[model samples]
Target: MKRSVVVRLLAAGATAATAAAIGLTLQVPQAAAAVGGVTGYATQNGGTTGGAGGQTVQASTGTAIHAALCNRASSSTPIIIQVSGTINHGNTAKVSGSSCNTADGVIELKEISNVTILGVGSGAIFDQVGIHIRDSSNIIIQNVTVRNVKKSGSPTSNGGDAIGMESTVRRVWVDHVTLEASGGESEGYDGLFDMKNDVEYVTLSYSILRNSGRGGLIGSSETDTGSGYITFHHNLYTNIDSRTPLLRGGIAHIYNNHYVSLNESGINSRAGARAKVENNYFKNSKDVLGTFYTDAAGYWQASGNILDNVTWSSPGSDTNPAGPSMPSNTTVSIPYSYSLDAASCVPNVVAATAGANKGLQVSNGSCTPVSPTAGPSASPTRTAGPSPSASPTRSPSTSPTASPNPPSGTNLSLASGAGADGSSKADGTSYGNVRDGSLSTYWSPSGATGDISVKWGSNVTVARAVIREPSGTSGSIGSWQLINYDTGAVLKSGSGAGTITFTATSLKKITFRITSSSGAPKVAEFETYAS
Candidate 1:
């Protein structure tokens, strides 16, 4: 529904034409040069060293990206495919109704190895098009913004992710990218990143995954455990409800990432997955850590993590915060040496480093990164979820001190949904947009006349509230009152779309009553945080 969601979008159910399995054949012209020259991108994991070397090729569209991927002279020769401009819905998986009946979607990197897809020039964007990596290895992707990747309306392919892989994918380094979405199942969007079917030896760094239901998943199903040795570091996961990451089985290193405003579950490790969780910043979220939502549990060796402005739900006996109760036999030592950023600096460090347009400005978090002379030598372990944050050049011992992040008190309005707005869009938007933690969607009053409010199950001590304006609108609220619904107290009043700072000591309900407006007002977010 919004930017970059279609990257991993998939609806329920499917047919032969609709199953998006890996290994779909790509039809490429016979004449294009197979050698590719790709450059000006970040180096990769899996022992890839130095700059992107090989033949350089340029592509301007989704078909062109696929062509570039398929144009490799041989599987062993590294080719660089520089993609610039927009890769839209053209030449992607075929769509029928809301579902894609074809197997391949957008750019399909199938049966190709030693490839680098670099976003060059002004940058590369995958809009409503999913990039499927199937049976491929030794790849690198950088400086790309994949937005509105519609999950297949039908389960046409396993690559219903912004950047996804299936069946024997290995050694992929995805860096400095932006993956986005609208909302979750209710909004018809899927995971920002999804990997499955024997996928291994992948690293995602300095990336941003935003506004979606699922962050990503490793291993296909509860019974699928062939995946392992994945590294997630220095990323930003924000404005999503859950699945900061869901790991099934593997040895994963999750460190130095920022997670903000998580609504439901976060860092779901299950089915024998093992994650070494270190030095991550978890803020304004719930269930920010641990195994959840399944009978089979996962494992984590967690340290140097900051849980600030966070809450947790009672997810039955399976959720283990200290780490999964799995035996030590399944654990694997983290392969690379890393430094943890003080949790206090995550929000700022990530803000400065974690996106495609950042020109690869990585924070010297709290440690200097030293690459091993060779690739990781360990046998294999398993893991998944949002990463952490740290200095790239120094350790926390040498970093400057900022105020420590505040821990989140209980969220009294967790169960609250959006209220009625007279001018709300009927096409697809809902009043719930205000609280969905999405930047692509928003709530608009049908008229200048209605009130927007939320009621909590019990009274909450609210210290701050932020009412974010929408993406593009000229209308503004001329007058509004922040009212305490349970006690009928006007906590504060405002006349514009900005931070609504007030102190509600304890209240069961709170509302923004719009008494007057210049036009039908729209709000991208109406959030309340407790400290």
Candidate 2:
């Protein structure tokens, strides 16, 4: 296992859980009162005006509202505003309030904290970003719906991020915030939430981003200040198209997030940002990431992130490069070079509570280490004798041989196995199969029957034994398929119990699927055969 992976799993998971629990229990605390009678942030009060269906506030203009709200502080005094009717900028969702660009639209903040922004009435339609924070700390933005901020005409030259956060902002919490249609070239911007500058101890949870051109939310660091100690969990990144910007910036923790990118990378961390991309589901991404810079000063860390069943929108070939391409200057080997073992990921309470030091622990979970085992080896214990049944019977084995160069057919076989030491460690609840022996596991879904693991050795197609489930259990040993993990090709498939045998040059790992009828089913003692 790698140190980067272990540290990432702990820090990112804990921070996100803490923020969620805290945010739910203790609503965002109000900012402390302004000190020394300083100027506070302000928002434009567009006076009531008659419209076609209802009366609208003149200040309801995103620019006007932003001008009135930016940089204004509500210290010991909570400055609150109530508005009525729709605030329209453009029709597109990505347009920001800054696009209105009346000099008055820009609100500025300095030396102020303990601020609150709440929406009352139906809340005016937000043509621009509802609120923008800059050079401020101890800030809370909650219970606000920032919607319909498309540019009506053209966009402001530089435009604004729906929630543009810059400068050094610390201990800031944003919750129950809905940012809709806030990104794209039309708005001359990117991302529903863009936060740069020096930011730390910040948490964004329970937030929803929809109909955006780029990332549901985006984070980066100022040129000098490094962006670390940030948590983005429990947030839904949905319906992002080609317009979405990359989801990440500098070093941060991103997990437990359901990211769906119709067109673009699900989550990208560029500019040498170290991140832990874990437990996230991405749909239609060219690659999990474009690149992971592993240079001395820059690089993003990846681990435990499930790349399960992602369908690529466009497949690129060697000659034409229109779709996702393989990573450059990277090695593609049988065993993942820095892969983390399955058992090590879970928690270990004994080690966790005993030391009480800073480390990763899955509160009520424990990680039981499962060592890797190799195939059968040659030894002189048993002498080779023939003519028992006239023709020699195939031997049950694990070791496999490589195929000739440019071999055809799907690749298959076991990659690693239990450790040779055959030792077991039972410090907690979970158990690890430490013993080095012939044991097997199988998956059988309803309406499906058989599955097999095949390997080729010495030009012999060896079919391993079948360890079917106990009899009279209404279990079916058919309807299973063997799939090669790397090339996404089917080696051999069959229905009903029996044996499936195939010969291939080399083997790594194979998957047996039961078509997922109702739920996933498990069987004991799947056979492992070799020739």
lDDT of each: 0.60, 0.36
Clashes of each: 59, 55
Q: C-alpha displacement of 411 in model 2, angstroms?
A: 66
> For residues 65-106, what per-residue lDDT tens digits would candidate 2 score against the true structure?
332232122211122222334444332122122112223232
User: Which parts of model 2 have CA positions greater than 4 angstroms off?
Assistant: 1-103, 106-111, 120-125, 148-158, 216-225, 242-249, 290-531
Candidate 2: residue 104 lDDT (0-100): 29
Taking the tens digit of each residue's C-alpha lDDT, what string does model 1 give over 1-531? 111222222332332232222112222222212111111111212233211455565667654454334434333445566677877764443322321112445676665555677676888888777778877666778789987766556423334578888886756778778999877765667778888897767778778999887888887689887776677877899888777678887777777888988887788788988887777888788787777877788887777788877776655776655422222334455434443566677777777767786666554434322221211222122322223332111111111111123225443333454232221232355767777666577766444534566555556677656666666653476766666543334566657665555554576556666657786666666667664
RMSD of 2: 26.4
> What's model 2's overall lDDT?
0.36
Candidate 1 segments whose C-alpha is farther than 4 A from its true place: 1-46, 49-51, 91-104, 152-159, 321-332, 367-531
Worst 10 residues of 1 by lDDT: 34-43
